[model samples]
Target: MDAIREWLAGHKREVIRFAVLFMFLAVCLFGLGRLISGNTAETDTESLQLDETYLAASSVESDQTPVQPQESGPAQEIIIVDIKGAVKNPGVYQAEADMRVIDIIDLAGGLSETADADTVNLSQRVTDQMVIYIPAVGEAAERPIAVPENNLTEQEIGNEEAGTEKVDINTADAVLLQTLNGIGGKKAALIIAYREENGSFQTIEEIMEVSGIGEKTFEGFKNLITVGAK
Candidate 1:
C-alpha cells in the first residue's frame, strides 16, 4: 500500500495540469457560443426595424397622394313656334332662335300655290311662340276687320273721335292700309302700285288716280288718309 501511494504522489502534478487545460478549453467554447447567439439576435432586431420603416413610408405616401374628380355633362337649347293658313304644312314646330321667317316657312313645307307671298314679311326674324299666318290670294276679302282696342291711349281716343291720325298713303303698306274702313287687300295693293309708278302724291286727291281707289273710296277714307310730303 505504501508503494502504490508513492507512485500516485509522483503522478499527481501531471494529472492536475491535464485537468486545468480541459477546464480552460470548455470555458472558451461556452464564451464563443454566447457571442454567436448575441450576434444572431442583433441581426433579427435590425431586420424588424427595416420592415417597420418601409410600412411607415408607404402609409405617408398614400396620405399625400391627390384624389381625382368626376366629370360632368352639357346643356341643350330649343324654341317653339306656330304656323297657320295657306302653307303646305301648318302646325306648331320646334326651331332655333337664329331662324328667320323664310327658314321657318321652309320647315313648314313652304307656301301653298294660292298663298299671297307679297303680304308675308319673309325677311322678318322669327320669335319664340310666334304665330305665322300665310294668307291665300283672296283671303283678305274674307278676313274680319281688326277690332279697335278698348284700352286706347287718351291721344288715340281723341284722334278716333276727331277722325284724325290718318295713315300716310305714300308710305303705308297693304297691311297698314287695310286697317282703314272699306279698304281690302286688292284696293290697298293697287294704291301701292300707283304710288311706286307715279312717285309720291302731291295732294290727298292724287290717290284717286289708282284704278281701284275711285272718288267714292277716297271719300270714305279721306279723313283717315294723308299724302305725306316727298
Candidate 2:
C-alpha cells in the first residue's frame, strides 16, 4: 500500500494534464455541434423566407392581369310605316330597319281573308313611312297600291301634315339642321364643319360621311334632307 501511494503521487501531474486535455476536447465537440445546428436553423429560416417571397410575388402578378375587350354589334334601328287596305290592324305601326312587307304584314295581325297576297311583292324590304296596301282579291287598280316611302309626293304630304319641311343639308344652319329627326346640337355642328371642310354635299347620302352619322343615323333623316339649295 505504501509503494502504491508513492507511485500515484509521482504520476499526479500527468493525470492532471490528461484530465485538462479531455475537458478541452469535450468543449470543442459541444461548440462544433452547436455551430452545425445553428447553421441548419439559419438555412431553414432563409428557405422559408424565399418560399413566402415567391408566393407573394405570384399573388401580385395574378392580381395585375389585364381584362379582354368585349365586342359590341351595331345598334338596332326603329322605323315607322303605314299599313292600309286588307291588313287586320291597318294604320301607322313601328317597324324594324330590315323588315320586309311580309314581316310587317305579320305585325299588322297578318293579311285579311280577302287579301290578294299574290298581287303584292311580299319579299320587298319595307322603309320608313311606307304604305303597304294589301288589296282585296280580284281588285283592279291603276297606280301601284303599295307605294314606298321614297315616293316624294307621299313624303310631301307627311311633311306638310307634320309642319316639318325637308331641310337642305347644303344650306341649312345649325338651328335649321336640328329640326331634322335625331339631329342634335353636336351633330348639327359636325355637319356644318364637314360641309365647310369638304364643300356642299352632292347627294343626301353624303351626309353619312360626317362622323357619328352612320347609315342608321342617315336613315332617320334621309326623307327629310336634300342636297339642293333652298
Candidate 3:
C-alpha cells in the first residue's frame, strides 16, 4: 500500500494537465458555433433589407399617374369678300366684318407694281358679299354705271316699282362696295369697321379715316354713302 501511494502522487500533475487541455478545446468549439449562428442572422437581416427595397421600388412604379391634354374652344362667324385687282391673285377672299381693305389686299397677296392706286380710296366700310375691284396701271378713266330712271317700258306701263340700286350700309360688305364707283370691298370694309368701332360717321367726309381714303376720294363719295345706326 505504501508503494502504490508513492506512484499516484508522481503522476497527478500529468493527469491535471490533460484535463485543462480538454476543457480549452470544448470552449473553442462552443465559440465557433456562436460565430456561425451570428453570420446566419446577419445574412437573414440583409435578405430582408433587399426584399423591402424591391417592394418600395415596385410600389413607386405601380403608383405612377398619367397626364391628359386640354381641348379647344368654339369658332366665330366671319364675313368674307371678293377682290379683283392688280393684286397677285385676283380672286375671291374671305375677311372679317371689321377687317380692313388692307386685310383683303394681304389675302390677295398684295397689289402688283402696276397697281395705280394714286387716286383710288382703299379704306372704306364694307359689308357681307362685297366685291373689291382694283384697276391696273395705265388703265384709262373708269366709266360710270348709269343710274337708269324708272321710265315706263313697253312691258312695264302698270308694273310694280322697278328695282333700284340702293346701298345697304350694314350689309354692304367689301365685295358689294367694290361694285360701287371709285370704291372696292376693302375700302368699304374699312368704312364699315370704322363706323362699327367708332359709332356711325357724323358726315360722309368722315370716311377719310379708312385705311386708304384721301381728300379727293372722300370728295367724290361725299354725296353717295350713308351711315346708319345698324
Candidate 4:
C-alpha cells in the first residue's frame, strides 16, 4: 500500500498538464466551426437579396415600355388648275383630287357679276393642269345670240366665236396648230422641234424666236393663240 501511493504522487502533475492541453484544442475547433457556418449564412442571404433586386428591376422596366401607333390611310392627291376669264379671282390654284369645277370656282372667290354661269358645267371634276374658262354674260353661249338690226351676218358671228377658241402653243400638236391663221404642218413641226430642243416656250412672243417665224407671222395668230401655264 505504501508503494502504490508513492507512484500516484509522482505522475499527478503530468496527467493534469495533458488534460488542460486537450480542453484548449476542443474549444479552438468549436470556435472555428461556428465562424465558418456564420459566413456561409451571410453569403446566402446576400445572394437571395441581389436576385430579388434584379427581378424587381426587370419587372419595372418591362412596365415602362411605350406602345407604337398604327397608320391611318394613304396621302391625298394634289392637283393644279388655272381659273380664268370672268371669275372674280382669276389665277392658278391648288386643289384636291376629289374637287369639282364649282369647288375650284369657289376657291377663286366664286363667279363674277358678268360670268355666264349657264355656259359652264359646274358639276365637272377638276383635273391637273386644267384650264377653267368662265365667259362674260354677253360672250358665246349655247343659245343663239339675237342678230341685231346692225346687220351682223351669221358667218361673221361664227368667225367671232371661232376666234374665242385660242390655241395653246405649249400643248398644241401638228393638227391643232393647223387650226391657227398661218400655221401649216411644216411650221407646226418646226415649232415642236424648237420646243423639244429648248424646253417649253416661256411666252407667246417666244414662238417668234423659232426658225422661219417672224414678227409678221406672230401678229397673224398672236391674238388667236396662248402660251398657257408654264
Candidate 5:
C-alpha cells in the first residue's frame, strides 16, 4: 500500500491531463451531432415530400380534359334558312337536325319589338328553302269590295255582311263570278275552269290572264282580292 501511494502521488499531473483530454473529446462529439442533426433529417423529409407532390400531380393530370377519342362513323349535312323581319341578329346561322322555326329564331338573337310572335306559326316545321312572311298588324285587314250597282243587290244581302268579298282564286267559277257586276257569265266560267285544272294561284294579278277579264274589271277587283293568304 505504501508503494502504491508513492506511485499515485508521483503520477497525479499525468492523470489530470488524461481526464481533461477525455472531456474535450466528449464535447467535440456532442457539438458535431448538433450541427449535422437538422440537415440530414430535413433532406430525408424533403425527399419524401417531393415524392408525394409528384404523385399528386400525376393524379391531377389524368382527371382533367384531354383530346377526345375519334370514332369511325358517317357524318350528316344540315341545311338552315334565315328569318329577318322582327328578329334580333337577323343573319345566317348553323342549325341542328330536326329543328323548328322557333328554335331558329332563338339563334338569331330573339324577337324584335315589331315581332308579333303570336301571329307567327312557330309550330310549323322548318323547310330547307322555305320563306316566312311576317306581316304587320292591320296589313291584312279586309278591304271594302265595291258592289256594282246591279252586281249584288243589297235586298238579298244583310247590311252587317255588306261590301266584303273574299275571292277564292282556286274555286270561283264563271257563273258564280258573273254575280259580280263587272264579270260576265262567260268570264266567270273561264275563271273556274282555269283555277280547277291548275293549283292555287300565287298572285291576284294572275286572274287577269283568264280569257275575258279586261283591264277595267281587273282594276276594279284589284284591292278586293288576295291569293293564298287571309
Candidate 6:
C-alpha cells in the first residue's frame, strides 16, 4: 500500500500535463469549425448580392430600350389626266384636285414653241380622267370662232334648239368632241390631226377622212355636229 501511494504522487504532474494538451486541441478544432461556418455564410451573402445586382441591371436595360412607332396608310384620292398635242411630253399624268389646265400643262413638260396657248382655257379647273389638248399655231384660225357667252344672236339660240346642240367640228377641242356618241380620245385626236393637216372641214362628212372614223361612225354624229361657216 505504501509503495503504491508514492508512485501515484510522482505521475500526478504528467497526468495534469496530458489533460492540458487535450483541452488545447479541442479549442483549436472548435475555432476552425466556427471559421468555416462564417466563410460559408459570407459566400452565400456575396452570391445573393451578385444575383440582385444582375437583376437590377437587366431591369434598367429593359426600361431604357425604345419602342417603335407604326406607319400610316396610302393617299385618299388621286386625279388622273391625259395631256396631248404641242406639249414637250404628251401622255397620261397624275394631278391633284383643284389643279388648273396650266398646272397640268407644266407637269407635261410645258408647251412646245408651236403650241397655240390661246386656244385652250389654261385657268380651267381639272377633273379626273379629263383630256387636255394644246393646238399648234395657225390651227386656231381654222377653227370656227367660239361664240361669246354673253352676246348670242337669235340665230345662234335657234341653232341650239334645232337639234342636240351641234358641236362645231371645225372649232371643237378634243374634250368637246369626245361628248359626241362613239367619240373617244383616239377619235378626237384624229379629228384634230385631220383639221391641222387638211385645214378646217368643208362639211361634217369630211370627219370620215380622219383615220378610224368611217361612214357608219360619221353618220351617227352627223346631225349632232356642224362644220360651222366654211
Q: Candidate 6: deviation at residue 33, Å?
A: 24
TM-score of each: 0.31, 0.40, 0.33, 0.37, 0.31, 0.35
TM-score of candidate 3 relative to the true fold: 0.33
Per-residue lDDT of 1-230 in model 1, one digit per residue for the tens?
Answer: 99988887999998789899999999999999999999999999999999999999999998895977866645434555556667899766777777778887899999999988887778776655455667778764332111121212222221222442568988988766765544665777888888889899888888888786666656555666777867
Give the number of the best model, judged by TM-score.
2
- The digit string of per-residue lDDT tens for model 2 on 1-230 reads 99988987999898899999999999999999999999999999999999999999999999996888988988768866667678898766777889889988998999999988988898998875566667788776433555653353323322322343567899998766754545666888999999999998998888888998877656655766778852
As for TM-score, the candidate ahead, 3 or 5, is: 3
How many residue pairs clash per model? 0, 0, 25, 0, 3, 0
Residue 63, model 2: lDDT of 95
Highest lDDT, which number? 2
Off by over 4 Å in 2: 1-65, 69-71, 150-230
Q: Put the candidates in TM-score order, highest first.
A: 2, 4, 6, 3, 1, 5
Q: Candidate 1 vs candidate 3: which has greater lDDT?
A: 1
The lDDT of model 1 is 0.69
Error of 1 at 135 (Å): 30
- In model 4, the clashing pairs are none
| lDDT, residue 180, model 4 | 49
Q: What is the C-alpha lDDT of each candidate?
A: 0.69, 0.75, 0.61, 0.72, 0.60, 0.72
Supply the global lDDT for candidate 2: 0.75
> How do the residues 1-230 of candidate 4 rate in per-residue lDDT, one tens digit apiece?
88877876898888788889999999999999999999999999999999999999999999996878988888779866656678889766778988888998999999899988887788887765555667788885532221111222333222334445677888888766654444555787999999888888889899999887877667655766778756
User: What is the lDDT for 114 in model 2?
Assistant: 94
Error of 6 at 173 (Å): 0.6
